[model samples]
Target: MGDNIHLDYKYLSSLFSSVESITFEQYIINQKIEHAKELMVYDEFSLSEIAFKMNYRSVA
Candidate 1:
């Protein structure tokens, strides 16, 4: 994403952390977790499917 914006990833992450009080990676994980919960509520996918969709290596 930072590459698309022509900024170094480390710099972008630092800026994001300064403004959001959380690391950019953590923010992405939080978003993925929230999306997984929403998908679970809809009952449209299995746990494994959700994990895969969220880019987790495994359902573990």
Candidate 2:
């Protein structure tokens, strides 16, 4: 999906026009955290593992 989509900053800014209080990257991080919460419900995965799967630089 990343290869197919060119995520330009200006385009992302326009895409998240309704979230005026937050930057696009922050919005994405929030979304990722939400998804991580959903994934966390599955007990087979640890938070550190999920963080890595979500491409976080540090699990802390």
Candidate 3:
């Protein structure tokens, strides 16, 4: 919640006047997923830890 960069995620839907190819939410999700995959290289990080680190409410 506090650490999220896209804190105004919902409101951003109107800010983007162009770029209809992808929504901001989709972009953020993709970036987070890719980041999680990159973090997989480290042996110390568990899936739960990664989820929490990413500010996710659940590990789904």
Model 1 / residue 18 / CA error / Å: 0.5
TM-score of each: 0.84, 0.60, 0.61
The alpha-carbon deviation from the true structure for residue 21 of candidate 1, after best TM-score superposition, in angstroms, is 0.2
Cα deviation at 57, candidate 3, in Å, is 1.5
Model 3 lDDT per residue over 1-60, tens place: 323664564455645424556776777888999898888777579989999988888889
Off by over 4 Å in 1: none
Q: Candidate 2: what lDDT? A: 0.80
Q: Residue 54 CA error for candidate 3 (Å)? A: 0.6
The most accurate candidate by TM-score is 1
Q: What is the lDDT of residue 32 in candidate 3?
A: 94
TM-score of candidate 2 relative to the true fold: 0.60
Q: Per-residue lDDT of 1-60 in model 2, one digit per residue for the tens? A: 234577876766776766677877788889999999888987678888898989998878
Choose the strongest candidate by lDDT: 1
- Model 3 collision count: 0
Clash number for model 1? 0
Q: What lDDT is obtained when candidate 3 is compared to the true structure?
A: 0.74
The CA lDDT of each predicted structure is: 0.94, 0.80, 0.74
Candidate 2 wrong stretches, greater than 4 Å: 1-8, 11-15, 18-21
